[model samples]
Target: MNLLNQTNEKIIPSLFLLLLITGLFSCTSESELTQVDVVVYGGTSSAVIAAVELAQSGKSVVIVSPDIHIGGLSSNGLGFSDTGNKEAIGGLAREFYHRVWQHYNDSLAWNWEQHSDFGNRGQGTVAMDGESRTMWIFEPHVAEQVFEDLIAENKIPVFRDEWLDRETGVEKENGRIVAIETLSGKRYRAKVFIDATYEGDLMAAAGVSYHVGREACDEYGEKWNGVQAGVFHHTHHFQVPIDPYVIPGDPSSGLLPKIADEKPGANCSGDDKIQAYCFRLCMSNHPENRVPFTKPDNYDPNDFELLGRLFDSGWNEWFNKFDLIPNRKTDTNNHGPFSSDNIGMNYDYPEASYERRQEIIQEHANYQKGLLYYVANDERVPEKIREEMKNWGLAKDEFTDNGNWPHQLYIREARRMIGEYVTTEKDILGERLVPEPIGMGSYTMDSHNVQRFVTEEGYVQNEGDLGVHPHAPYQIAYGSIIPKKEECKNLLVPVCVSSSHIAYGSIRMEPVFMILGQSAAVAATIAIDDKSAVQDISYLEMREHLMQKKQVLSLND
Candidate 1:
């Protein structure tokens, strides 16, 4: 190794430096660093799919995930499907559902719910198929099994529970990511990198710009932008006014603990507050294998007064949405004012640290579990409602290892990267054109409440609820996944792609992410072949590959 001498001059003690020393040195040094054709960050459903596709395409690929599990929400408890237009799905995403059908092919898979009773209908779309093409709904283990099968068949490399160096890990030269260093001091080099995390952590760390919250309607020409007051969906609003002060009726007591001290944003503008998050719990009626709801150690009965008020006002019909998956488990979600979704309490979660995020996740779990415990045991919850709550318990066959609690918490919206191409509501609503289409997304632009605060008028109110339909399937641009060529050329982002809060609401689903992941792999392969930037990858070539791979691009006018 040569060192710079005094005065910082290139004191080349050139003793016959004619043997191509630097070239050989680079070859020897870089060889030790692990290299792959593709490196996918975030072990989400999409990241796994991307790795499998690239490996199947005869290219070496590796997936590095922060979480221990493989699948994102799909392998988590989100077994209940969220498909708006089922026909719009194709490619690997369709294959995922098809694999679920194969799992249920064995008669033993029906041990939980009745063959006829196990309904696959979600909203207007049917998640199951008698034709055996796809059975979209499944248990957590079933989903995990399918992902494992894909990994095994493709022989893809996967490193679970590997966190990326959130700062200063991305090594970029000539506008291309040459390699990335994880927190474990291991370096991974790849021709192309795909950010497949919901939080957009890797993308953000690589200097890929990303948006955090919703944009105003005027900013993007969107109809359903900004704070929507008086628009209550699924019974999470405050019909009565409750003061934000410490006391029940006093105004001079100042803001309470849960309510933030900052002023709420203008009604027409956007804010950083994201919608609520929850766990897609799996519960069963089988008492033998059931885990009864236990009071959380940090449970506070006062945290449930708002729910008690909602229950008192004749909203006791709790079983309105106990969507049952296979293996005697139900993918139960929030229903009433105080349920699984800790609305308005998870605003700062998307951008928080892992440890901080865990705190938030546990906070939600405690709140949700407390809600169940309260409804089942508390005297104020009404006898009829209490009885119904008591009968429900965690499914034993599902998440059997850890007190029957869900391993994954539904992080609905986290850190969304402000990428090269922002996918605004205008694109999904068909009001504006999105260039360089990669895949399609067809789901409702749905956002849960972000804040559940008592209004100044002494009534309770939940804010940050917006629901709009993406009337038809719309194309997602390839540019949305990558940074500008000047910023980083070799990175592709699927989960945290550029989208307004409204548009992300529709595109954030796992199936869409999987489809985009396959498309990103195709683009990466093409980029590697041509030695081109991610932005410079020819759409003609990418589009051809996508069409050949059966990944949907556009819908007919």
Candidate 2:
């Protein structure tokens, strides 16, 4: 294997340099030595929780992340917290939110708005719990600070901006990862490994089996696994008929920009297309804290023509879900048919190269920024709607280094590991009891639109917007987090657990990730102690360990 630059040019070193680079293997050099009991990958909210749990379990650990900032969506403008059934959340996940509550208790934390003015509000839940003293909604910085405190308190080593050298970095011996290296030539040798990343990058590099896209309903016996067209139960579908063509009523003219010309697939067939990804914008209307929406440098009016048409069709519900956080900030997520989710454009992101991923991120940023500018200033927008939109802008104090923009994109679904068991709709709906419960996921099986295409009737429609409520909070199986017994015995996956697309939609919440992360760490420590594969660990012992950590394994009657 060779390390290639962006242009695919190889950089070869002299034999002496090669010897020096790999000297730790031959000469056991101390400088190149990095040994730990547990090595966690990704800087997500789950990653931090897992690292803390490992340290608390009396084990040495390190966090290897490609991001400059940690906490993933929790600190990336997802302050509204997409938590369902908070009672199901326990352990480190609840502690993180409690920390957020503690931060806001300080009078200095409320800068833009008075604490009284920002009354308790959350998505179908209580924002503040007096008895628990935990705040579920907060500004982005508060969440980041809480994560930083977790790291500082534990004294866990972290190496940020270290991309995994996927092709040749992971070294394995007899189907077990012995050591892994990063693109910066940093190596980590560990007894056990956990892939806590949303993308499952480390698991993939270690040759673990995983699935990328939706599985067919037939394949998993799931009701909502595959391409779902004509499933317009939400307001996210085009409310009124809108012509997708550039020149209305003329077939010769091309379709409007951003409106795909492809035909959406059969209703229940599997495809390689993933759900849309977007930067959850943190916005505010306060005069002191608001930075007015600025037109992106590559703004294109034609990109959002369909939105103008929606406005003309008497669809003015643009602010339906501008979920408010503390300090006058809003977690602005995709609300309607044409919103922040750059649908269909992120199909290539899950497996794209780092350079290509950056380009895709920039494109999403430009598109969302341009959409805000259009809604605020475009003449085609309804006067009343434009006026309301003009009042909201990016928060001035948040993401100060990135021009008040979110640093992380909401990767709703990605590469899911195909492990010992796959969590399907049956598991989520409580039709089938998952054995060896590790954690619980109660969020609705929510998936954003996957494709926006023209219908046979010549109207634009968005497919794959699904929101099905589960019968109750369901237990996540321990087998779902461990890879196949034959593939990789020492590795555990938390963020990208084995699940079908529809089930993962519910399990993909940040709180659920943290819960699974803590569970993963417990299992990892146990596996190291037993000197056995993660799949071979005793389920009873795992459940007992999780319960000792305050994890809720089974639902109460």
Model-by-model lDDT, in order? Answer: 0.76, 0.87
User: Candidate 2 at 369: error in angstroms?
Assistant: 0.9
The candidate scoring highest on lDDT is 2
- Give all TM-scores, in the order shown: 0.90, 0.94
lDDT for model 2, please.
0.87
- For residues 158-185, could you state the per-residue lDDT of candidate 2 as single tens digits? 7777788888989999989999988777
lDDT of 1 by residue, 236-317 (tens): 5555444555566665876554455544566758877787788888888777767889989988877776566567666665
Q: What is the C-alpha RMSD of each candidate to the true structure, in Å?
A: 8.1, 5.0
Q: Which stretches of candidate 1 lie over 4 Å from their true place?
A: 1-32, 240-248, 251-263, 555-557
lDDT of 2 at 401: 90
- Cα deviation of 284, candidate 1, in Å: 0.9
Indicate which candidate wins on TM-score: 2
